[model samples]
Every structure is written in C-alpha cells, then in structure tokens.
Target: MAQAGTAKQPNILFITVDQMRFDCLSIAGHPIVETPNLDELARTGVRFDRAYTATPSCIPARAAIFTGQSPAHHGRTGYEDCVPWRYEETMPGELAKAGYHTQCVGKMHVYPARSLLGFHNVVMHDGYLHHNRMRHNVAAKDHFDQVDDYLVWLRQQVPSADLVDLGLDCNASTVARPWELPERLHPTNWVVSESIDFLRRRDPSKPFFLWMSFVRPHPPFDPPQAFLDLYKDAEIPEPPVGDWAMQEDPMQLGLNPVTDKGLVPKRRLKQAMAAYYALITHLDHQIGRFLQVLNEYGEMNNTIIIFTSDHGEMLGDHHMFRKAVPYEGSARIPFILNDPGNRLGLKRGAVRNEVIELRDIMPTVLDAAGARIPDAVDGRSILELARAGSASPDRQQDASLDSAVQGWRPHLHGEHAYGHLSNHWLTNGKEKYIWFSQTGQEQYFNLEKDPLELHNAVNDAEYADCIVHWRQQLIEELKAREEGYSDGEQLIAGIAPRSTLSFLKA
Candidate 1:
C-alpha cells in the first residue's frame, strides 16, 4: 500500500460524463444500461448516493467542478464565449503547482470553448455543441454531426443493418453526410484512445492527472446500430408523470407549459429513450476500453480512478428533455471513487449513501494525491472515508466535522441564467424551494415522501412555516458562504453571502 508522501504519489484518472443522469448506471440500480466498467469501479470503490452538482448547467457546472468554488463565486454562470481564467482556481492549476503533469481531453465546455486554465496539456475533442445559429457567429460548416460519423462507419462494418431514421434534427434526414467511419471517430472512442495512449506512454517518474471527459449520452440522441440494437427489445421503464405542481412545493418556480409539465406522447418518449440508452451503452463501451488499457499496463492497481458526470440529464423527466432543473433526475449524479491501495479507506464493492457535492472532489483528489488541500477549498475531504473503506470512520469523522463540514444545509442552492430566463433552487434535503420571479411562480416539494417530486406542497397552509424556515436558512447559508467561510463555518464566519457581490448573484 502507498502511504501519502512516504513514496511516489498515485496517478489520478478523473472521468466525467456530460449530462449523464444518476440513474444511468447499472451500479446505481438502473435496470437498462449495461455499464459493466462503471459497475466494476463502484464495486472496488466508494459510491456517494446524494452527490450533486453545485450549479447543474453545462459551462457553469464544469467551471465549478474544476475550480472547487460555486458558479456564484467563479462568475461563469451562463454560456459565455470564453472563461475568465483570472477569477478561478482550476484543478489542473493546483496539481501543476504541486509538480504533477496535468492533462485534459474531451468535452470541457469552458467557453470560447478553448480556455486551458492550467493543464500542462489540453487536447480538446468536443464542447458545448448547441445548435443555435443566432446565439453567436456559429458556422453550419464547422458543425460536424458526431452521430453521422459513427453511423456511416457502422454501416460499412456490418452491411445488412435495418435502421430507420429517428427524426430529431432537420439534418437527421439528409444522407449527404459522409458514411465512412474512421477508427477514431465517436467522441467517446476518440477521447478514450487518447486517454489510453497517455496512460501507456507517460513517464513513470512523474505523477500524472488526466481528465477524460466524455461527451455522450447527452443529446442529438444518436448512436450507431450495434449499440442501438443492444436494447432494441428491452422494455425500458419511464419517468414518473402526474399533475402540474401536484407534488411540488409553493416555493418552486417556472412551471412552463412546454416543459416542467409532462411528457409529449408515448411513441416519441420510447424513441428518445431508445436513442439515449444506445448512446449510454456506446459511451460505456469506450469507458471499458480505457480501463482495459490501464489493466494492460499493469497500472490498474497503483492508479486511483474516479468516475462521475458533470451534471445529470433530464431525458424526458418532469416533461423536460435537457437539463437546467432542480428535480432529483437533474440534480443527482453518480460519484464513484476507486483507490485500489485503500489509500483513502476505499473498500472494494462498498457503497455509501452519504450526501456530497462537486466541491468535495477537488479536496478529495488533493488529499489522495498528498497535495496541499488549499485553504480556499470549501469542501470536506472524503479521504477518511476512503482510508477506512466504509461508512463507520466517515460517520465518526463526520460528527467531528459537522459543525464545520457535514450538516445538511438548511437549504441547498442552485442557479441558471440562459435563454432569457433566470432560475434558482433552494432545498433543505427533504424539501425543495424554487423562486423564479420571471414566471411569478414558486414551487416546493417534499422530496423525501415524493421522491419523484410528483406533487407540490408550497401553497399548502400545512407547510407554510417550513417554507419560511427554509428560506431564512437559505439566506443565512448564502451569507455565510459569501463571508469567506470555506464550508460556511468559522473559516469565513465574518464574511456574509450577500456582501460578496457579483453580477451572477443577482
């Protein structure tokens, strides 16, 4: 076993899936997707059930994950063309400072889409592929449909495949798109290939950190025939559907008619679902390849691998197709920590139902790497939990850290500012409070009783006090964080959340 600082530090391999939901993994008990590689990692690592993204949007969430700060603190809330590197502390930057070789591949969504904050090397593959022509100077020529590349190649590989067009974009009908698929085509396969090459070719003397961010199971809902066929007749379950704000609380907001209501129809739901599952399986296969390379190099035992998604996807959940909501389907993400040497108390096949957030990852990796846990980090390290390989030590240590790090927030906070709308979420674990002044609506949900968030409880007089109490708690918590409290305790007790002002906070 490798002890921190006594010998060479272990290499860190962080893999993040773009817009992958919590329920997409087999290890998380999703009956459909065959995620054998992820299951193996979970079986040999610690899995966090209540893990959440601080801000569940694309660019903002990615910014927060790498910075160890919230979107509110970093100021990259919306789809800005370029990230302002001056205001953030990215993971690679810190690792590079500590003498580690840092590198990143695949979808980073850092806006301008090319901001290399601090990685020693960044080989970007794909990022923030939105189809809005008017949003910026987007050229139709530069936009290469990833699905087309995969489909064309699959056809040549397997000649007699019966695949009908599942119409999504106007481009889906056009066959003019090239058909010959290169070996290094699909974003997942391409990224994984680069990742494997790095693992196999890196110098053993210097420790390395690689961020293999996969941009799949996201959208365009396009996967090749083989993957699409994997779940062809596999009856997949559907997300819950009920009355508007039925299980919602009064504090929630923006219950639009098009979205945040219910599904469109059964046929379309099934088609979209099939495509989503196909993409997931394709991405899964690539992940397995990346792992196979690690095993081949005999580095699987000494390397620490962590797998998670930037944020959850709301594939037809709560009447939503994409993300930017506070529902469990959109907020919760799969967080797996696999350290083979039991470096952080990680036990093979142990799962923990602890609540954690993206902010925790920076400190956790830094702790595992024997790098300094910067004073600026606001998250608690899960190193203790990984060290003992169970919840017992984590629970005991959590007790000592609660006053400083472990208590459930009286209100969890989230924000979104995109497409002419600003949305925010505040929750107290069991109940969620949302206020969207633009739509003049509030939504609340007893998440514990209504796990699907089917009913709204905000307007009910019975839960009136609960609303006020949680709202006040939100204000206090926000104030404390703003006041410079790393974990909203004594660290920054003197600084108030409201006092720290950025345009994003508004």
Candidate 2:
C-alpha cells in the first residue's frame, strides 16, 4: 500500500527552457510568437501568471529547483563556478530514495558538469560552459570527448560538423539568423529525440521523473528556416520603451558591465526578437512531438506535466539584454502544471495568481511521490496550497510554508551582484520596488497600471508612502541575510556578500 498522506505515485515530466521571456507564448497574449502546443498545456491545466525565479540567473535559479532552498540558504548567492554542490537534501535525491526512476536528458549545469545530484543516469547535453571549455585549461580540447554525449552523436552523424560552421556564438546574445543546419540536427530537436528514446528504454514498473531541458529562446538566436519564414512577415510589435530609456548606451553611461543593452541599434533588436520568437514556435512544435510519443506509449493518463523556464530574458525590455537584474523581464517566468488525472482537485484551465518560485518544485515533486519533505527544505509545495486543512504538526518551518500555501506570500525578495550596479527587488505581483544597492537609486512600478514598466514612479507624490513601505521591507529582508545589506533601519551598500556561503564545505 502507498504510505499514509501520500497519493499514488504519478509520472512527473518536468520541462524547462533556458532564458525564455514570459510573454513569448500566444496564450500569454504575445503579439508575435505562436506556441500552440504550450498554449494547449495551459488550456488543459493550471497556468501561474505570477511565477518568479527567486534568484534570476542560471546557476542560482537552478540550485533553488534542486535543493528546495532559497539562494541564501543554499549558499549560492550568484553565478559561480567550482562551487561544489554537496547538499544531502535535493529534489531528485528525495524522489530517487522514494523508488522513482529519475533521469535528466539535457542541461544539468551543475559544477563538475556531470554531477547527477541523485539521478541514476543522465543523457548529458549542457549547451555551453565557459568555465569548462576555457582554452587555457588542460582538458579544454578533450572536454567534449569526455563529457558531451550530444557532440559525440553529432560527429558520428556528420564527421565534418562543427557548431561554428553555422556561424553562431553560443555565448553571444546579439545576432539572429536562420539555422544553417537541418531541422532534425538542431540542439532543440536533439533534446526531444533523446527524451523520447528514454521513454522507450525505461523500466515500466517504476514511476519515473524526466527532465527535458531545452537550451533555446536563449542566444545566437538561430531557428530553423521554416520557423523563421513563419514570422518573416508577421507584424512584431516594437518593444515598449521605458521613460528612462531614451539613451541606453551603457557605453556612454560608463556602466561597469559593458555588455549592457542600453545602446543596441534598433534594427538588430528587431531581428533578434524575430528569431527569438521563431525559436519558441519551433520549440513548441518539438514539445508537441514529444507529447505525441507519450500518448502513443499510453503514459499520458497518469503523468503530471510541468513546463517552466530557469529565468527570463530581458529581450530588450527596459534596455536590458541578459538576466541577473531584478526586472520582470529578467525575473518572471512561465509556470504551468497539467495534472491529467486531476490528482489535486484543482480546476482545469484555472489561472492561479499567487506568487510562486522555483524553490517550490522540490517539495511539489516529493509530495506527488508520497515522499516526506525534510525540515531543511525552505520551499512549500503548491499542492499543499491547493488542498485545504493540510497543516504541519511542527510549527517552526510550518510558519514559513503556510505563508505560501495560505496565499500569504506578500513579499518576495531578489538580488544580483553585478560589478558596478548591484540590484535588489521586492514585489507582491501587483507592484514592484527596485533598489540599486550600489548607487542607491530606486525604481517603483505599479504593475497593475503599467505592466510594461514604462514609467518609474519613485519620485511621484502619489507613491511616496508605498516606496517607504517597500524600502523598510527590503531592510528587514536583508537583515535576515548574512550579507549585512542593512542595519535595523537603513540599507548599507558596498558590503560585498560572498557568492558561496562559508559554511558549505567542498
């Protein structure tokens, strides 16, 4: 019999896309992108309109998904390398211990590159790692030969094939062009192909967890020629320019991170966005193919499907390019949960507006598998919030978890350690207050009135009190962190917080 308080184990299919914007789907009212397959998922399940990545960067955001802990608790405050992940508690570790066959098909960006967390096996393909592939490193030449499964297959398919032959830079977020290679050979297609192959090779008796992570809608902006043609004549809207974005050239402003998008040309932005949207459409079609395979195998009935992103790209919003800042373009993400068997009693196609975070993924997966969440976990299970009368016997961590499940997530704190202009944000889904920790500049936006963040009302008399309240809230939040961001009353900038917590042993 299944353990008490645990429902029958259901197959969990968690899908993630890297650096995708929130409004890229047709269902989300996007003007250009048409993601019919993703829209179908939203139509059949619950879509969260206010989901966020607590730490809006690659490594920190992914760590929250794995450990069920906030960036501060997990000890990875920002993007870092060689930070050994030795956590005894992890999402897959808990699920694997509960007898589920967990496997990750793509993009496990963990240090050591091949660390499985707790997965029994992984068909590895993390798109790019600047740290591992450093030209000066001794193992640089042999890096792919030793660690990359996708590259091995690519070479076998076409011995002369090179990622550079397509004239794309994996790290550059600038250009947009039609994919020079065949559609079937694209990285996005390869991830789906491998995931389908896994379903064919799995042990049918055990409930399974599959992570199909995609690397596109990210950089180099190359979609297959057909997808590009689909949007070639579409009327893509101009990006909503902010009141403060008249002169965005970070070069002119002397911004420390020179890669800032303040000065990108108008023509380039249009091409980049066009290609970005096409990639989403292509990705959506691949997902549709994946779903068709699952249906053919008769596994969709009992499986719980989830779709989300690691973090959002700015996509030229507010004159920003990549993540690491606290704007909605960089922090907000798409979160959809399709419970095919209606295990949670949540109304189908319901739009849940409560604030959600990536940290919540671990406990939610554990709860689905009849596995107990540990006291060390800081994230709450969304399922706990949907069902009533679920309370913990212990009140210590229960108090924190209740806030989310009970719809009491009044505030979510976020930050990033950029070189010259570090920033932090506090939001309640309806409004936002941003603080430039280094420069002491503040930006306030009422998302209810201005979803585009066109105006900054920090100095407006109408919102002076609202600004004061969020500022104090930030002060209290930083007091809880080890960074010493504030005194009891006021913020104290310039105290550098360590990337990895000192307590974490390698």
Candidate 3:
C-alpha cells in the first residue's frame, strides 16, 4: 500500500477482457486451457481467487469499475441499450486529477457510445454492438462505418472485410471458426498494437494510466486459425450443470435465438467451450506481446498492471448460455494485481482468497497513484490489505482484527434485472444464495463442497438456517431499491419488471 505521501506513484496499466470466466485460464487450473502467458503474469502478480462482479453484465459491471459505486448508487441494475450515463465521479477523472495522464483504447460500452468518461482521449472500439450503429436507422451501417476505430482500420487493411466474414454472430451465435482476417488484423491484436502505439507517442513527462481493453472472448468466438486449430481436436470439458438446473427459465432463454436459447445438444456445448477457450489463449498471447512491448519500452519494471473482465460468460452453465445470471460461471471473474516487483513491496505470486469486487479497482489505483479518494466511493483499497501482512497493527485501519480476519468482507450483494426477472446473489465464496425474482425461487449452493455448483442445496435440511440468514440480508438490501421487490420483511414476487434503472423515490 503506497498511501504514504513520500511513496512514489507507479504508472498503472489496466487491462480487461469481455465474457471471460474465472476458471477458464491455466493459471486458475483449468484442465483444458494452457494459458502460459497468463500463468506467467499470475506468477508476478497477486491473484484474487474470490473476486467477482457485483452486477454481472456489460454496462452495469463497467459502471461499477469506472464509478466505484454499487448498483444501488450507480443505478444500472441490468443491461440496457441507449441509457444515459451521468455519473458525477469516475476512476480516470480522479487519476488525471492526480497528475496522471489517462487514456483508453478498445471497448468502453459507455452510452451515447462515445462519451469519454473523463479520459484525456479515447481511441474507442466497442466491437460489433448492434445498437450503437444500428437498431434505429433506415440504413444501418454497423460493420462498414469508420466511426469505430477498429472497424475503420480493418476496412483499410481489407477493403471488403465485414463482421460476418468471420462466420460468427456478434450477439447470439455460439459457433466457432478461424478468423477471416489476418492474425495481425484480429481485434485482439489490433487493440494491443493501438495501445503500444499510444505508449510510444504518450507524453513522457507524467505518470500515465492506460486502459488496454480487449473485446474478444465475448462473442463471435473466432480466434485466429492457429489458436482455433490448437483446440480443434482437444477434448474440451462441458460446462457443469446443477441438478436443479434441468428446468429452464423461459424468461432468460427466450432472449436469444433458438440455437442458443438453452442447453442445446452436448456436442454443441463442447464446440462452444472449445471456441471460447481458444479465444482466451489468443487474448493471452496478445497480452504477452503487450507486456513485451512494455518491457522494451523499459516501463514494465515501474508500471502496475491489473487484469480482469467485465464479467464471466456462462458458456452453458446451468443451462445458461450468456450473462445476467447469479451463478459462479456468470459472476466470478479473473482479477489479478501486479505491482512492479522491483519498485513496489507487494507479495509476489500471492493468491489472495479474500473477497473483492469491481468497484474496488478505482480506489486501489487512486491510492497507489497517491491520489485523494473521494468520500463518496464505496470500495476499500486492497493495496492496504496487501500491506497489512507486513505493516504493524497500530497503523492498520482495521487494527482491532487480524489482517486475515480484517480482509474478510462480510458479504457482497449482486443483482440484475434481466431474464424477465431479477436474479439476485448473496455470497462470500464458501456458500452462495440466489433468489430469482419471478417465481420467488431460492437456490443455495455450498461452494466449498461444489465450486462448479453441481447440486442445488436449497432443500437440504442441513442448510435451512443458512438460507434464512441470507434471505433476510437480501430483504434488507432490496428495501432500498426503487422496485418493490421486497417488503422489508419478505420478498415480493413477480412485480412488473423494470430494466432501466429507476429513481429512488422521495
């Protein structure tokens, strides 16, 4: 924890991936994926084994990261298109205030599609989104438009290239194939190259904060031909399905096309997993290149790097094909924090099992930059936790508790108003409780015994009191939301669904 005014600020490099699962990487011990690059990165950094997204969807999850606020405060409880984002504070805005030059490249899923959110400048590339360039026009020009920087550069490379040529759908398809464009022209590579270019031309006088956001591994699961071929013949494992997951929720499944509506045939599930893992390896390789570029620039030894995803893809877990669910496959994300080993005193190769979430990123980085954290922010800086192991008790914020006990966050609340219902989560990694708003259904998973959520323990007599405790906690949490999902004492089932955030009433 470099909170000392005398501690020098390290340049921050924040990297992100879309729809990447928590355990899909070799670093996380995935049986099929061999992510040597990410594994090496993990060895240099501290990996948070219990990190998660409070709102496990693109728009709201990113909002938590950027604003350092819970969904209750940020007000995006689900995925919605064209919703206005008018937050008063943001991570990059505060970083820039502390004399750090902040810039971003790649996907920003922010609304109006081009709002900078306080970055000095952004070379925006929100990949293959339907609403941004389509959905409300007589002449919809999504892939052909130059307004998206990646699409424009792609067109310059091959004047006839289009998104469909890759043989994958931007939104719904779970199909797999080799990328139609050259490997260098792939969106994953393009993002890194653009970031390296920005680094070369960045003002060297100030410490910089760069967001290298990759939009791959989200959809259009088309990795380069070589990456795909690596997994073409491998036996990719099928997503774990819970005993209670046999029954599908039409509210959630109906949103996608028939091909991806629910758990299709096992063969299709295997192909989807194979393709998805291929994308992870491809992204890992590009990350290796990005790190090499940093090393060549002589910045690797002085830079702080953090890697995580917006949220996890279900990949057919619990008959769920995409996000907006409360399962571990949908909510758990890969979160790694790498402090420059020579310049900073963070524990090397430490695996932190204490719970953390996306909102925590803002304050952690700002504290590292030696910036003043806003009083309104909800995240606690994890750097302080890392330092607590070595710092004496009197100086620690939670001096009354041991650092190991102090790092434990009692619980985190997660909810999303998708699937035509509110899927809410309450968990601390040992056990998880999910309350689906439509049927007033409850699911309990003992994550200690079944990390894959293989069996729903909701009816087991052994866990009755555990369910009541969590449910009451959820009740108190929902009482503050605009939707009347709870009556302060019990949950209210099947209230008219609301997707766009609702204003807290006077």
How far in Å is the alpha carbon of 82 misplaced in model 2? Answer: 2.1
Alpha carbon deviation, residue 214, candidate 1 (Å): 0.7
- Ranking of all candidate structures by their lDDT, best first: 3, 2, 1
What tens digits encode model 3's per-residue C-alpha lDDT throughout 36-113? 878877787778888999888898899998999888888778887667677778999888877778899998987656
Error of 2 at 324 (Å): 0.9
Better of 1 and 2 by TM-score: 2
Error of 1 at 232 (Å): 2.1
Off by over 4 Å in 2: 1-7, 138-142, 246-258, 384-407
Question: Worst 10-residue stretch by lDDT in candidate 2?
Answer: 387-396
Clashing pairs in 2: 248-262, 249-262
Candidate 2 per-residue C-alpha lDDT over 211-312 given as tens digits, one digit per residue, 9 for 90 to 100: 999888777688999999988777777767789665545354313222446656667667777888899899999999999999899888778888999999
Better of 1 and 2 by lDDT: 2
TM-score of every model versus the real structure: 0.79, 0.92, 0.92
- Model-by-model lDDT, in order? 0.63, 0.80, 0.80
